[model samples]
Target: MQPSEGSRIVVGVDGSPSSHAALRWADRYARGVGGAVEAVSVWDTPSSRGWSGPAIDPDFDLGQARELFERELHEVFPDGLPDGLTRHLVEGDPSEVLIRASEGAEMLVVGRRGRGGFARAVLGSVSQRCAQHAACPVVVIRQQDDPAR
Candidate 1:
């Protein structure tokens, strides 16, 4: 679909380096198309179900986490951002939210793998799902390789 003035470029952010790259790429594309940018972060608190694992604290403090997410977005958005820029912190699955938001967007962007180690070539669940099901075109941003690493 052709990008219009009200068209949106949706991006999924997890506050990771790869996610940040996706946000930057989305920002540039949105600017070039004279469209809006939506930076969405999905936060789903784990439930204390009948599962055996590490002891989970039901009352984990998420205030700091939200603050960090906002701060990181600001940092990624250098040279200032457009007024159309929006940050959404929804409580749901990342892939679901991304697909729903992309219904009306011109395009969607996400990281190949977010905050996870996939020694070889493997796409993260969220990115993979988005790519397979999103209504709009999707771009998978790869994390930059550090020469020092």
Candidate 2:
């Protein structure tokens, strides 16, 4: 079936190795599916308040975040990324942003874990939430092994 304009694949990146892999995978899938890829990164302003603080900064630096998202695209695709590829920086909880974006996406791709220090045996909160609530299929790419495997 032909993918709708809103059916572009969405990948979440946090400048981490696993997220890089997700970008690469999403790019390849987009090409094969004759669709575009969305390179998305949700940046929140660091809050001074305790755990109940808002997820994103009211004055989030969108420009810098966009640059980082584009840089990540280049790193994953190297020579170039597919045409129609776009990047976005939304301010909010990562899970909420991704889930909302996924409403129009053919699929959502994310790393098994994010910047949080945790074992691969579990998915990051964002990834877990996306997998549970996304409108489309979700792919969680695990980090590469340390070569001892």
TM-score each candidate. 0.79, 0.77
Per-candidate total of colliding backbone pairs: 0, 1
Write candidate 2's Cα lDDT for 31-147 as tens digits. 777788888898765563356555765455666777787787787777877788888888777888999999967899998767754532365478888999999999998767212
lDDT of 1 by residue, 28-104 (tens): 78888888889998765455324534565534525655786788877786557657889887767678999998997
lDDT of 1: 0.78
**Top TM-score hit:** 1
In order, the Cα lDDT scores of the candidates are 0.78, 0.79
Supply candidate 1's per-residue lDDT for 93: 68
User: Per-prediction RMSD in angstroms?
Assistant: 4.0, 4.7
Model 2: which residue pairs collide?
45-57
The deviation in Å at residue 32 for candidate 1 is 0.5
